[model samples]
Target: MTTPLLMLLILTLPLLANRLVGRTAAPAATEAAAAWGLGLVFLFTASGHFVQAEAMTQMLPPWVPLRLALVHATGVLEIAIALGLFTRRWRTAAAFAAATVLIAFFPANVYAALQHAPMGGHAWGPVYLLVRAPLQLILLGWTWGFLLRGRTPKRMPSRA
Candidate 1:
């Protein structure tokens, strides 16, 4: 709930600010805002890895090896993806990376939901999937719509 709201706020506030300043024609501003917003979302989620390490570890299935280490590694990866999104050179790659990470982590979410893991929202039980699944899809769509799709590579000049 709060996460989605935060993402929306971060993504929209910049556009609103730009509009106030009369920078309406700049699509780059929109893209920058989206990237920054998504980056912040990742940073926020990553904080949970360290701040609630025990609860986060419970999100994983027992079969998963080195769950705590995996959680910490993913936290680092999210931080990296967040930083990468801030740069034009890496934005697309970071978006793709983010999408992959989102997909990769989803099964754990499902597991946690079904198991009613005693974490933040997961404790809500299997019904939590009702919210989590769509949120996951929305995040994926955001990555694609704002960061990945329609970005063509710049053509080099002809030697002629």
Candidate 2:
């Protein structure tokens, strides 16, 4: 339920991106990318809720071998990054944070794939590991390019 809603939100982001980029070409694609990237970050967090939906209404995936304290920390970071993405001043920072988080979660994806963990009875576990594992790195690069490169103003201040 939440996953679909988050996916819808992600798909709608391009519309928001178009409007945001139209306002100023300086941030331009970078801002849109940041928004899109941030949306994914939110979507990723939402997906985790699906993984552990049975135990609690909203909770981390129990399969993950991490302390409760670490899980809470991750939740805090996700919310903070989500908030950061909402404003222009923090957009780039949000992108960076989201990218970092994505990279950090790669191992779990890999483990799931390798372990052949059954998700929703759709088992292609190892295949998923091979396919999606690389995606994390690619997304990191895309966000880095979109946010870091796009955010940089093309014109340097003219030295008199």
**What's the lDDT for all of these models?**
0.84, 0.58
lDDT of 2 by residue, 54-132 (tens): 4221123555555455655666677777777666677777777777787886665565555555542114666665556
Tell me the tens digit of each residue's lDDT in model 1 across 1-160. 4655676676556556766887765778878878887898888889999998889999998998999999899999999999998888889888889999999999999999889998878988889888888888988998888788986545568999
State the lDDT at 42 in candidate 1. Answer: 88
Q: Which ten residues in a row have the lowest lDDT in candidate 2?
A: 51-60
Screening candidate 1 with a backbone cut-off below 3 angstroms (N, C-alpha, C), the clashing residue pairs are none
Question: Worst lDDT window (10 residues) for model 1?
Answer: 7-16
Q: Which candidate is the best by lDDT?
A: 1
All candidates' TM-scores?
0.87, 0.60
Clashes of each: 0, 0
Best by TM-score: 1
Q: Runs in model 2 with CA error above 4 Å?
A: 1-26, 33-37, 50-69, 120-123, 150-160
**Candidate 2: clashing pairs of residues:** none
